[model samples]
Target: MSRDLHADRVELSIPATVEWLLLARTTGAAIASRWSFTYDEIADLKLAIDEFCLTLVEGPGAERLDLAYYLENDSLCLEGRTVLATPGSQAASDSGATGAVTFSADLSARILDALVDEHGISDGPGDGAKTAWLRKKRNPLS
Candidate 1:
């Protein structure tokens, strides 16, 4: 029997406009529910996703954010790629908050730490990363 249960991937190209952040967040939140994540787990997943998206939307004039979601039977993987339009640092997400901090001081690292602590983080292809293909169902593979 194949170990793969089933998976879905959703790719959304979001304009770096601040308004679109909510849309990206909502889309991620909706997808999380499909795997039976609890409320807090769902919220945490959304926050991690938003932070990932924020990383791609930082800077002064950028116009796009690459938002990706990989859904499996017991896990949800999210990745966001951003291009800064100016000569400054990128935005980062804070711990426990479903939001981003522009030009964060170590908050970006915190975001990764939090996600890893909560779920577990993994690096993806060049310039991209998988926040956590968090394993929610302990025995889903069984």
Candidate 2:
């Protein structure tokens, strides 16, 4: 069976830093709200993205963050990709690094899982790159 096209598709690429997270949040909220997601749902999308970025900012070789938003039937799907810092390299030494933040992968995953209906992580095309995704379905009650 042929699938329907996305209602909308947006892609953004920015430096992977805390200061740039606002852009991601704004884009997500705009898309979600335009797609008829409730206010609460929009807030959840922003929060989930904030948390997701926190993990990426701390990742080694995370120089750039790329995100794509797709509006699917009854759901919004977001896919993110970033290159990982090479092993044994001090890629996290820049001023962007605040203190030593030890974030657990499992913990991050759990938080994302709670925020969205579905979440996924996988290896990117580039070596040492990682890709993460989240999907939030429109609430039937809303």
Candidate 3:
């Protein structure tokens, strides 16, 4: 029998706006809790999610954001992507670009480093969409 690498996973998509950031944070908190993550760890996950999501929304003005949460052994992984608009699409015209916008700031990087075990922002598979990801390990003692 083959075991799935991810024991549990959840996917979410929301309009790329600050107004929707609360939902993203809430989702992270809920998933972290389900895995029995400590309260401090859950708070860290929520803050990390908010920071990364806010960067995507505020930096490049993405039209939509896609997020995936994966539960692995003793860790929760989060992957968030900006849905790049197609060339000549209404969204592209509105945003004034078809290529993904890179998100990088010294303060944000430092904050994520402190909050999560591992984190990064990179280009996604197609259309150069930007994707940000993080992994938070459960505290063994907690």
TM-scores vs. true structure, each candidate: 0.60, 0.78, 0.79
Clashes of 3: 0
Cα lDDT of model 1 by residue, 6-86, tens digit: 466778876666678788878877877665567776787667666655554443344356766776445666656553333
lDDT (0-100) at residue 4 of candidate 3? Answer: 52
Predicted candidate 2 versus true structure: per-residue lDDT over 20-76, tens digit per residue:
879988888998887778999999998888767665565556677889999776888
Q: Between which residue pairs do clashes occur in model 3?
A: none
Judge candidate 2 at residue 138 and give its lDDT: 89
lDDT of 3 at 91: 49
The models' CA-based lDDT, in order, is 0.55, 0.75, 0.77
Q: Which portions of model 3 miss their true places by more than 4 Å?
A: 1-6, 87-104
For model 2, name the residue pairs that clash: 60-85, 61-85
Determine the C-alpha RMSD for candidate 1 after optimal superposition of all C-alphas.
7.3
Tell me how far the alpha carbon of residue 99 in candidate 3 is from the true structure, in angstroms, after superposition: 19
